[model samples]
Target chain A: MSTFLLILITGIGLGALYFLVASGLSLIYGLMGVLNFAHGAFLTIGAFTGLWIATKVFPNPTTWTFIFSMFAGGIAAGLFALLMEQLVITRLYNRHIDQALVTVGVSLVVTALLGGWFGFDARFLPTPLWFTKAATIGDAIIPVDRFIYIGVAAILLIAMLSILKFTRIGLIIRAGVENRSMVTALGINVRLAFSTVFFIGGFAAGVGGVLISVFSYGVSPLMGGSWLIYGFIVVVVGGMGSIAGSAIAAMLIGITNQFANYYVTGLGDFVVVIILAAVLLTKPTGLLGKVSH
Target chain B: MLRWKYSRPLLIAITVIFAILPFAGDNPLSKAGLQQTMAVAFLFGALALTYDLLFGFTGLLSFGHALYFASGMYVTAILINDFNVNFLLAILIAVIFTSLLAVLTGGAALRTTGITFAMVTLAFGQAGHVVIARDFGGFTNGDDGLPVNADRLPDFFIGVVNTKYLYLLALGILVFIYFTAWWITESSAGRVFAALRDNEQRVSVLGLNPNRFKLLSFVLSAAMAALIGAAMLIVSGSGSPRYAAADITIALLLMVILGGPVTRWGAVLGGIIYSVLSTRLTVLSDGTAFDSLPNFIGGPLAEPAFTLGLIFILIVMFAPGGISGAYYRARFKYLNKGK
Candidate 1:
């Protein structure tokens, strides 16, 4: 029973990271109608940024410092995404295949650049004092970091939901996702909305990257590629643009991956891929995603 | 019409150039190293041509086409090494096996369109990589890869090491694939493929089954990729799980896209140029020429994947039509000026 609890907690911790990454990917794909392959690169970029801030810029690290670094990472990714959108992605709208190719190129370039600047060596962020301790509940020991991950991810998820449900910008984004042409017809600058959403998505990805890096206690250049693939699977399985679906599917994936890894080594990713294929065959639109094709 | 006419003469000239490239060195038969490189280039050419068949003609952006190629490589390697099957027979069986695999996967993949198809293929391709690297370690040797030695082949051809024979074989296979691609593009079924590319709904309106034509192209492309993989086993004498990697598929796509997707000869040219540039650039970067530069600027820029990614971006942004498109426009302008 304790083992199951530990596994469940581990699953949630990882699922939170996936949710953070996939939400951005899903939102961007939903609104912009283009999947940013470089979304994963943003996470890597953010991880490096947060790591840099934590280590170099703020040497005297604390919980507040760590939190600040995560935001710095998100802001950095957001700014970069804004620049990339203006310079590259905005021009290729509606051209799906071209957009995909270009984004893939972006992903490759970003990954290479990261690999070049910071060698391929993995870097670990310093764990905060609060996270270094573990809480024991009924014979099951839960690390403080896992609880932190769950808490932060839950907050972000609720914040995103509230924004989407109640905020003006959120309403516009929702409208844009439903019908870009209709939003344009209504005199909304759809491009501006897209750019804004792109920034938010980038921010989310960056935050996720920082969180995952901290959770795992190591960050590497290749992390983005693997996470991006997982994020793609989550988004596709959850249904593109569906935040709730992404969260739910991410949990499913996280749990499955944990169980699979515990039972069978190296079979986790293969099972996820198989699940994706199955979803594509039966639910082309995803579990909660509207059928576009 | 004029473009097709021009393409024929142009293709012949390109073929002639490729046929003579190795012999242009000091001695006709002694340039084994160069011949080996060109053989690898031709193998890439075959890959690019097959990719163009799907992306250019059928309008399918498959991110996992390497699965088929890797299937052929692994199957051929296994048959030759484990089963003690004759090398030639293993290749034939590998091709048939991969074609059937393509049919099965393509059937399911074709049920979706555009991005979904791409995602599905990506998953399948990754699955291939995972399975090869893990589950089938007994058969595949996992991440370590399976090596084919000279003794694995028949006495007729000295395996992989005899660069001369491998070069000729690669060239012969490339030529065969080029013509096959040409014939497919000019056939009635090829017309349907083009129609599907232009407008799937319109093709359906015409009462043509788009899936049938797509599956045909997919299987053909997969079979051609398998043939290249078979040749790769002969040339490289090993099958790495890397063959099924997403990077390999991406590189092949870049080759086709850089050449102009719809143009068969262009894809061949793209393959040759891409292969040459990648090999040469990696060598140069690792050499002493760039050692004086600062690490920040020189280190990342010197990496081949970084350079290639930058080039890919530039092509996508400034020259989406690629080299062939540029070539066609230039020739059109030249001929029209005389008229």
Candidate 2:
């Protein structure tokens, strides 16, 4: 029972990271019809930026300093994404495939540049001492970092939901996803929404970068690639553009992964693939996805 | 029309040149170092042509084509190494197996269109990558990679002294795949594929099953890719996990785009050019050429992907039609001037 509890908590912690990446992916894909291959590059840039700030700028970071560095990473990633939107994505406009290809190119360049600058070796991130400790709950020992991850992800989820419910920009985004042409016909600047979506997605991915670095105990140029795959799976399974759906799917996948990996060793990834195949075959639009025209 | 008029003679001339490249006397092209590089280039040329069948001709942008290629490489290598099967028989079995795998996966993946299709295919491909990397049932030998058993091989395919034969074999495979692709794209079914690319609804309205033709294209393309994989194993003498990776598929996409997607010869040209550039750039990066420059600029120049990726981005943005497109445009301008 204790083992189950520990696994459960750990699964949720992993799922939190997935949600952070997937939320942005879902929203961006929903509004723009792009898969955004460069989303991983944004995460990578955030992680490296956070690493630089914590190590080079802050020098021996405390808890507050680390938090500051995380936000700094998110802002950096957001700005980079905005530039990408203006320079590359806007030029392609409605050419979805071309946009995807360009993003693939961008991702390759960014990853290669990171590798060239930092070498391909993994660099450890500085962490607060408390993150290294564990907490006990009814015979279940949980890492303190897991709680932080869950807490941070939950807060972001709520904030996103509230904004979508209340804000004017969120209203435009929602309308844009439902019927892009109709929204455009109504005299809204859909292009601005595109930029906004890219920035928000990049910012979220950047935050995910810092948290994932903390979760994994280090950062590497290739770190974002694997997590980005999981984020893609989450976005697909949860229903593209649905944040709540993404949250649910991420938990489902993460929990399944933990339990399967525990019991069967190397079969966790295989099981996830099976789940993906099954979901795609039976429910192609995903759990909450609308039938797209 | 002009392209079609000269394409045949051009192809024949190019083939003749490649056929005699190994015999070029006292030249760097005939050396073992360059021979191996050209052999790999030929293999990529064939692989990229197969990708062109799907993406360029059929208008399907599949992100998981590497799955079939890896299947061919691993299955053939495993059969020859562990079961002592003849290399030829192993390749045949691997090709059949990969065709069936493609049918199963492609049928499911084709249910989605556009972005969803890309995602589903990526998932399926990544599943294959994981299975190979994890060494399921210990058959794959995991991430350490499985080297082909040279002792079980034929005499002509054995050592560095016979690299010329491997080079010829790769060229032969490339020619075979090229002709096969050419024949398919010129046939009635090929017309249907082109039609499907332009308008699926129109085909459906004309009382044809669009899904069936798409599946056919997918399977045929996958089978060709598998054949290339088997040939690649023979050329390189090993099967690594990277064969199943997404990067290979991306590389194929780059080749197809760089060459010109719908143009068959363009894909082959793109693949050969890309493979040669990648190999040569690595050699250049290792030398003292970059050492003369400052650290910041020189460091990135050493990484081939940085340069190649920059080139890829520029091509996608500026030259959406690629090399063949540019050539045709220039030819048209020259002809107009003459007139």
Enumerate the chain B TM-scores of all models: 0.93, 0.97
Span of ten consecutive residues with least summed lDDT in model 1 chain B: B154-163
Q: Give the TM-score of candidate 2.
A: 0.98
lDDT of 2 at B81: 98
The residue-by-residue lDDT of candidate 2 on B243-312, one tens digit each, is 9998999999999989988889889999999999999988998998899888777777888889889999
Full-model lDDT for every candidate: 0.86, 0.90
lDDT of 1 by residue, A1-293 (tens): 88888888888888889998999889888887787888988998889999999999998789899999899989998888888889888787677677778888888888877877888888988756777788887899988788777787788899888888898888998887777778889898778778888888889889888998977778898888889988999999999888898999899888888888878888888888899999889989988995373
Would candidate 2 be rated incorrect, acceptable, medium or high by CAPRI criteria? medium
After superposition, the stretches of candidate 1 with alpha carbons farther than 4 Å from their true spots are: A129-133, A291-293, B4-10, B13-17, B20-33, B155-161
Worst 10 residues of 1 chain A by lDDT: A284-293
TM-score for chain A in each prediction? 0.96, 0.98
Which DockQ values do the candidates obtain, in the order shown? 0.74, 0.74
Docking quality band of candidate 1, CAPRI definitions: medium
lDDT of 1 by residue, B157-191 (tens): 57334677778789889999989998999999999
State every prediction's TM-score relative to the real structure.
Answer: 0.95, 0.98
